[model samples]
Target: MKNLVLGVNDAIYRACIGVAGLAIVIMALIIPWGVFSRYALGQGLGWPEPIAILLMVLFTFVGAAASYRAGAHMAVNALSDRLPPQVQPFLTLFVRLAMAAISLFMLVWGYKLCVATWNQYLSTLTWLRVGLSYAPIPLGGFITLLFVLEQLLYGDQHKRRVVDYECTEDSKEAV
Candidate 1:
């Protein structure tokens, strides 16, 4: 079950990153052509700026999805590391709960924001509605929450442990 969840998470992250990367590439090519058309050909591209901005927004949010799944987000481990050996389990539980709360908050807030803007259209890009702009927040947050839940529920202790050894001379020790 844990493996299946992780597999899904990895698939989502990779797909989002791939799409965002393609968006960036298309944006790069479009902008240069738009510039050339404006300056060299005396006619500006009608939608370059709008397209670029949209692609940039997509890149950031999609990249966030990937980061969350990979556990690459910035975090403070000071408190966890400072706890005594026996208290680590409790601390881990607390941290997971806090993360779950954050994810839920984002999900609710983003949904509200998206709903509020549903009727509005982007000024520069009339082709896009405002709801589309805010959609990524909830989507990314949900994916992040799922990833956190998987970790919280079934994290493997053996895989998480640190091993250290100092060799000592002994009669039975191999050279």
Candidate 2:
């Protein structure tokens, strides 16, 4: 049972990170195209700006979840490190619980916001529902919730230092 749960959790983590990576890649390609089209080609495309914004939303939200799991979020490492080892575990749990609550709030309210605006369309992309734009909020919350629960149950997988988003020993075996 433990192995199965770990396997599933790891799979989800990988998928989220993969999607985040793809979003970044897409943004990298389009932004340059937008700039080139405006200056070099002398015909600026309107679609790329909005597309880039949407892609950015995906990148930030999805990447956030993966970063959270990897303990890569901007944290006060200096302060946390100053604390006694015995007190750190409980302090970490307290922080995780607080984060979990925030995630739940986002999940519930963000979905409501999405549904409320479902019938509306983007000013730029009229064919695209505004609701779609709001999807990343709840999605990010959901992913964070999963990661928080997994950490609570199995303990943090971020046992070693991770440099530049690369997987550590704990994460590599799962992949």
Among these predictions, the greatest lDDT belongs to: 2
User: Which candidate achieves the best TM-score against the true structure?
Assistant: 2
- Which residue ranges in model 2 land beyond 4 Å of their true spot? 160-175
| Model 2 per-residue lDDT tens digits across residues 28-141 | 999999999999999988888899999899888888988998889988868679999999898899999999999899899989999999999999888889999999999999
**How far does residue 66 in candidate 1 sit from its true spot (Å)?**
1.4
lDDT of 1 by residue, 70-123 (tens): 657676889888989899999877877887788888788989999999999988
Instruction: Estimate the TM-score of every prediction.
Output: 0.73, 0.86
lDDT of 1 at 92: 76
Span of 10 residues, lowest total lDDT, candidate 2: 159-168
